[model samples]
Target chain A: MSGTDKILLVDDEADFVSALSERIAHRGLAVDVADNGLKALDLAGQNAYDAVILDLAMPEMDGIETLKRLLDLNPDLQVILLTGRATLQQGVEAMKLGAMDVLEKPARLDLLLDKIRKAQANRVLLVEKRNEEKIRKIVDNKAW
Target chain B: MPWSPDPRWRDSDLAFFGAVTAGATHELNNVFSIIEQTAGLLEDWCADPEADVPAGCDKILNVTERIARQVQRGTELVRRLNGFAHSADEPCCNQEMNDLLENLLALMERFAAQRRVRLVFEPAGAPVTLTTRPFILEQAVFLAVSAALAGTAAQGIVTVQLTGGGAGVEITITGAPALPEAELPAAVGAWLGPPLWNLEGRVRTAARAGKYAIVLTIPKISEEVP
Candidate 1:
């Protein structure tokens, strides 16, 4: 709804998260970063975000678990999994578990932004579809 | 299963190597990501059509270029690590000793810098090519450097030299005062002791005045079956 989208970045590497946060901010997006998966979930609970960029190999709770928890809290949440261990099996598993997409490590900033935009677009479509369903159900009840 | 028949030892060794290699590569990836982000920021700044050109853009570009070079160095270190991992399967092979030493130095650069120890490498007359398991040789060198650093004071210099001789290739590590006897961990000594003693080559250490020097001679080929 706002001009700039809100993005939450979660990774164990401090330097990487810091640098990426700065770069995303430069691209006119409001960015919040967490050092690990637990901190990421805490942040997700506190704020509403347009999308979350998560790292797969983290200490406390891994990306898959974190995504599950975040989605349970808000089913509409969009998640992008970023991992250095880009195994085919893991990628497919993430997508099956409701991740918007899986990206490899060292992904270009522009490419990440594009994925985020698509995720956001998908979120909008889902909401619109739900509203349409609600209207159709109301019309059916009135006719009966 | 008998103690000797169990596969645990091999599994543990594989796990240890895998963890170390993965951790090192992950750290290197983080370094590259930071450099990329910094360069992207500069490019964005330069591309701002409405904004005025900032002062000292040239200096920023120079610094970013330096960071890029460091990233390349990190990538090379990872490549060396990959090579080392593959070398485990090859018991013996022909290798350029100088290149191996350089790669080892690069691999340990961050560790040395963190400890404030200077690593100096002085190669012999010409590049010495040898047939050996370079990974094992690298492990020996790493252990020797760690020992030297532990013995040396902060900001001390650890010098590594390679020389060819009648026996084979001699790798020497020289540093400040000898490491304290109590500091030598038994496991490390055990891992290094047999190879240093049983191999045709010899590993010798001597206390000269106050400083210490460790010399390791590795033969061009193993005496074991081909």
Candidate 2:
């Protein structure tokens, strides 16, 4: 629990999300599932997640829209997009939107795990950088 | 003189086919993705030494059932797509309107899902078989439904009903208007033009305060014109 990476898995498919989340948890990570972008947003707002796994096509709000809103909430959030078919243009758009990576659906477990690990590591570095910046700002403003 | 289909119409037809195929394949990918994950989960369960055998067996069985359901879903999607592809085998053929509309609805489901709208097909009780340009008739209905969908807001219902009469069948598509009254005619025309011309069908639209209906009346036997 102390060092486990926590992730939010957002997909509209119940069985897919459940099985993927279970397998991911078995790999020594903590996973929370959301069936839609709105639920994912709620969870992301309330918790500090190392990364987010988002499906491209969903009801109400799509992955691109969700990515924008999530980034608005925390520009430092590491988002890994999953799509059934990731076109070149879509990949470029997602990268431009600050997604950590784009993965095709039916993603190999090992490959997905690798991306998740990288995302977690990258998130930790961002957090550390932010904390150091906070310390530097405080020191610069100190009276003593 | 030989009759050639309008190049623009042909292009639109191809685009429609491509869109349906892409959507169907995407759904198939989702189905397979679930099956793959469920299989992986079962493997993980089996590999756990401390896991109770009986509990693990139950979980494995449950996941197996999930896989079966996904397979069935994938099979049905493929079947529908096969039918849709074969729909172009003949420019004109004998067709049962109910069956044709059902297949179209299933294939167009992805479009409706994207729009967050509901597509309700109310099939005519009796068989409405006709000798006509079946593919063209289907295209016309497809366009009419698309227009209805465009005029419907998110979560709204677009209903398609079939009614057969003396010499033709009437396809009525209705929905709550999300688009302005003045804009609907042009929008409907843009979608329905080529197909309606080929099918020799007539479209009559009625709009009230909240609801609008687009009715397409297609003759039972349409003589293909050169």
Candidate 3:
């Protein structure tokens, strides 16, 4: 992926988040970390990220709820659910709520990077499609 | 065994065991994941050709410290899991209420966290020994705490206070967004009924303004006298 691909890593585990963020940052990606769903939403609202790495289980608002709200803010946002105790039901629920993918805890770094690359590409395509529609509307409204 | 040999009890016991084990194992997994990432970062720093020697050494020290802390956490979790597994060794045994409750709260910490509820235990300051079926007693306490957690709202606190006297011991579990008086019986019954019966324990529920408290009174020396 490009060094400009920025991602948000959300989890309640402080050490885990810090370590993972460092590893991701080391690979030349701009990474932001949030310790809870609320903080994550705040960051997501304020900034644009190529992808979001979210934890499934959190204190108040879980990943599923976060995923819903994140999509509500920007439908094109790509979220990957990473959890320590993931179940099939939870995976389905996340996917149904617009999550790009579900990954279990202690995930392989290479696999996560691959997903992030895909997310960045998907995001670019979505933004381009939305922009194209806007230009088409402008052209239709203009005088000949 | 003084308690009934009903199949339902067996099922309850197994379910509790399974839930606790699964939660603890999940916690251990997180600990391992942190250690793995921290170590990996350290390795990355070492492999970088243009790495800043002094800065890299400092970062390496921090990562090693992080790994050590997580290892200590993992060790503590395993110790508690081991203690929980042995609680069912005998039908009845002498147990210290404070230690037992501490172990239980640790096991249930994840359950409380998932709901954004805090579980606080106030020890009696002295060991309260009771000759009882440890497993049943733990189940009863667990049920009481579970009921309190259900009634509490997000970011609420469920406090378990232990008080022991010459006669017996009292465990008061209180939570906020209290249930109404009428609903208390049903809520408490669903969780504490069978286990409380086996412990020869009596439960008294009270509403304190906006909080509800369930106080479990058990004789210091169980009538079973095993």
Candidate 4:
């Protein structure tokens, strides 16, 4: 498994989550499933997933709240939101909250796969930048 | 008292109209999402090897059927919504009771289903056509239904029965209680003003078999809009 290609699929619909994860797995990517936001947070904390595919509406924690918590736990994590009933205002609000993107439901699998690959690349870049900053700081401190 | 426009009532009515449209659009969005996912699945199955995917074509066929069904449902909803929007285009127009209520009820199906209430429409006789302010009259009836729903038990039935006689149409709503006399003023406030009163010849409430009933008598519009 390419470490950066792992994804967490969070949605209340069990069948939809199963079908979608199967598609993602068929594409040669590792996927974890979470039926609700609470379970999603658990999976995120336990594994280093490259991104999350989250549904906007749920029973306990809605997409916006879950998105907030997910980013708080991993500032660099990429999150793509899915919504069956999305409005322009909701999309704008989600973007302002640092989501990688908002995709209306029944998103094309190929397009979603493409987005996942892009998110994986962006995460790798962020990690490399952070590592470079840390190394430079260490060298400067040592010299001082 | 002379007729005067009530801004608050207008605002609330507009808000109700907005909610109705929003509900229809949300349903369409879900339909589109299902179609997208199904088509994507079909493509995935088709892309794989024919030998390994004997059922691929069959699955695509099934998905296409499902998509067609969704499109039909979405089209019907859009058509009903279009009918409702046009109901307001003119101040006064001729309306058939059955046709008007069917479209309005289609728009209201979600609200009723959400509350687990079964809506029943009973036409006593032949189609009754009346000339009136179609939108206002429909709004008044819809609000009465909403009011009755407030007192209705979940899974209970709300019946809108239509009858015609002597140059007028009588709509009797039974199942849930009518808005109390004290609250009727606010519920029908602006819509029941002088101009509307002329359209609704009579309004009253009565109890039938321990169930509340609200009756609205609609008079035929005398003059056509120029």
User: How does model 4 fare in lDDT?
Assistant: 0.75
Candidate No. with top TM-score:
2
For model 3, the local distance difference test gives 0.83
Q: lDDT of each structure? A: 0.71, 0.83, 0.83, 0.75
Cα misplacement distance, residue A8 of candidate 2 (Å): 0.4
How many backbone clashes does every candidate have?
Answer: 0, 0, 0, 0
How do the candidates rank by DockQ, highest first?
2, 3, 4, 1
Per-residue lDDT of model 4, residues B178-225, tens digit only: 334444334444444443574756667665555777678888878765
DockQ metric, candidate 3: 0.68
Compared with the real two-chain complex, what DockQ does model 4 have? 0.21
Residue B36, candidate 4: Cα error in Å is: 1.9
Residue A92 of candidate 4: its Cα lDDT?
A: 92
Clashing pairs in 1: none
Interface DockQ per candidate = 0.16, 0.72, 0.68, 0.21
Candidate 1: regions farther than 4 A off: A1-4, A130-144, B1-28, B50-76, B79-226
Residue range B151-226, candidate 3, lDDT tens digits = 7777899999999854678999988753454577556655676777777788988876787888998775446554
Top-DockQ candidate index: 2
* DockQ of candidate 1 (2 decimals): 0.16
Q: What would the per-residue lDDT of candidate 1 be over residues A1-144, giving only the tens digit for each residue?
A: 332278899987665676678778877789999977778888999987888999887754678889888888878889999877656888888888889899887789989999988877877777788899999999999996
Clashing pairs in 4: none
Angstrom error of the Cα, residue B169, model 2: value is 1.5
Q: Chain A TM-score per candidate?
A: 0.86, 0.95, 0.95, 0.95
lDDT of 2 at B135: 69
